[model samples]
Target: MGDKTDPNTTKIIHPVYIVANIQNKVRILDGKKVTYSSWVKLFKLHACGYKVLSHIDGTTPPAKTDEDYESWSEIDAIVLQWIYGTLSDDLLTRVLEPDSIAYEAWTRIQNIFLNNKGSRAADLEHEFNNLTLRAMPSLEDYC
Candidate 1:
């Protein structure tokens, strides 16, 4: 019988690698809707829940010589698939690229939303209109 302490036979597993039902948990991210931030928030939360946040947190990959590189890349690809599955056809086409890892894909999607001046302006306006004089420490601070 094989012993439990055999490192060669042991395969370390992560939650993200286990396929789960995501129909209700992850909805399509509509770039045209006000739900952009909401969609991104939920996506990040999903990744966080499975402890694969690092794959999508914009961190550089480990060197090929590093012992963790292979495992890191495996998880990165899984995370990348998660990102791809949630995007709509239009967004998927826009963000998809050959051999892109999770971090690269995350940055692409983030830049697309963050650089939207219209959405940014609207969010700013909404916040500004609701700002109170007492919201800040002082009148000058509020202004």
Candidate 2:
């Protein structure tokens, strides 16, 4: 679907509209503590390929035609590769054991990082309560 021909070469050139091969090495997630910063980096990495996790997870159905299916499968494979390559070894084991669709695997990763357990919630609450605004010479400095 993403091919072009140059007048000089008559050979098909695949446009790098989606993820570039070089970008495939963006950043590997360590899976120690899932933070928004890392999640955003990973999200942008996939977004560059137009491989939105929601769509891949079947929030939208697969195309009905064989050709469409082939295209979808190719994209899915790219996503699968990126996902597998980025996760840490421990996270990889968790992700692999489920034997799930790409979307589900992605979701599992998100859940591992994003889920707010009671302990975490309480810790945040404690931190919030203990926070204090230091005196500042100016309003701008306080801000």
Candidate 3:
């Protein structure tokens, strides 16, 4: 096996976001411009044989606070899970629909991960896992 950082070694090879549009039904731009739908199509085309544009949240969240109860670590783990899960082509795709700001935020996160390949992957992973477990005990199944 070659260096993990090697481009060839990367299993999911594609810029994290070909377009910033993450919301499912909403259009990112006005008119026939770059809507979320368009972005998904573009991403699919560029990703080629690689899987992308998988999960999309089909429903709205139950009433909850807008506050960011999650820490940076938790956010990181969720991002990794989203990417890895999406690559597997098994996770429920409807959970990622483009109308949600949470999805947009997730796209930003994936971009950060792609830009910071040299960063401490293990530390981020640990922090994310811990934070997730603390927030939802049920998540222990995945952790």
Q: Can you write out model 1's per-residue Cα lDDT over 82-129, one digit (the tens) per residue? A: 888888888899899998888898899888877887988899899999
**All candidates in order of lDDT, best leading:** 1, 2, 3
Q: 1-143, model 3: which lDDT tens digit per residue?
A: 75557556646424433324323322232213543345445434533322333322223333345353333233333433433333312222423444344345446534443455556567668867677555665775646
Top TM-score hit: 1
Model number with the top lDDT: 1
> Candidate 3 overall Cα lDDT vs. reference?
0.40
Q: List CA RMSD, all candidates.
A: 8.4, 7.5, 22.2
Sort the predicted structures by TM-score, highest score first.
1, 2, 3
Q: What lDDT would each prediction earn against the true structure?
A: 0.82, 0.61, 0.40
Tell me the TM-score of each prediction against the true structure. Answer: 0.71, 0.56, 0.20
- Taking the tens digit of each residue's C-alpha lDDT, what string does model 2 give over 1-143? 77877668775432323455523454667744655457557555554556455434547646656556765655556666667666778778877744355666677777776785677779879977765556556667555
Give Cα distance to truth, residue 135, candidate 2, Å: 27
Indicate the TM-score of model 3: 0.20
Decoy 2 TM-score against native: 0.56
